[model samples]
Target: LLTVIVTAAGLVSSELRSGSAALTLAKPISRAAFVVGKLSAYLLHLLAATVLGTALCVGATAILFGAAPLGDLLQAVALWLVYVLLLTCFIVLLSCTLRSQLGVAALGIATFIALSALSLLQPLAQTPVGMADVVTAAMAGTAFSATWPLVTSAALALVLLATALLVFQRKEI
Candidate 1:
């Protein structure tokens, strides 16, 4: 979350407020390419942080939880990276549109809260139709669970990037 807000707000808002944004905007590069390039750099930086953080988090979990399953811990870390990248696109997009650091930060944090809700939505959407039925239902299990999450998240990230490119291109910032 800090990665998203800081990168987005610091990049666009500073330039926009200082009147230097026009120089970047006036560059010959396509806006989409510009956003893509910036996002790529941020992602590279994030990947490094993710690697270090995940190692520490998992190692700590291993100590606290006892006999932590290494594979599962790694899987959890990978999923987290996907989630972070997904949120990054939103923060960057809103920052591009609003051109205010505070606004961008608020938008990023708000979206974080919203999506964290959505991540829990599958469970919430399940309810017993009959009063006698259990309120909780078990999700259908599938071998695809091993792979589908990363794929689904990657696809969504692509959509967000496309949307950001389209919106950012038209944005005055």
Candidate 2:
């Protein structure tokens, strides 16, 4: 979670602070294109890290125990990836709006904590906020359905990304 927050928080604000965003925008690319490009790069890096980390974790689990449930592990990891992607989109939006990376990171962390607390409510248990519960259930090899949370999370991520692009477009370099 911290990884997603930190990486996304720096994606745009750091560039703006360092005066690189202005230089990059001076090129022929559209502002939307530049933002999308940065997001794509971050997603690629996140994918690689998630894959490698999952592989190492699985290997270690298998070695420590007699066997590891690959299906359960993969399911949990998939749900986790979806959740983290949503979080990354949120932090990216914050990064696009905020001038300071630290401010973005702080707000990102606060939002995470707030949502986590909200997820404790029964009414929000099926929402994206409850994704942690779904991931936990999957990891525990329990019967848990995450269809609503996954769908909502993906939809929210798309919305957040679009909003971020719009915000960046209106922002002054």
Candidate 1 has an lDDT of 0.62
lDDT of 2 at 108: 95
Per-residue accuracy of model 2 over 1-173 as CA lDDT, tens digit each = 87678768999999999999999999999999998999999989988998999999988988888687899999999999999989999998999999999999999999999988998897887789989899999999999889999999999999999999999999999
Tell me the spans in candidate 2 whose CA falls farther than 4 Å from its real position. Answer: none
Model 1 residue 13 lDDT score: 58
What would the TM-scores of all predictions be?
0.71, 0.96
Clashing pairs in 2: none
**Alpha-carbon runs more than 4 Å astray in model 1:** 56-68, 123-149
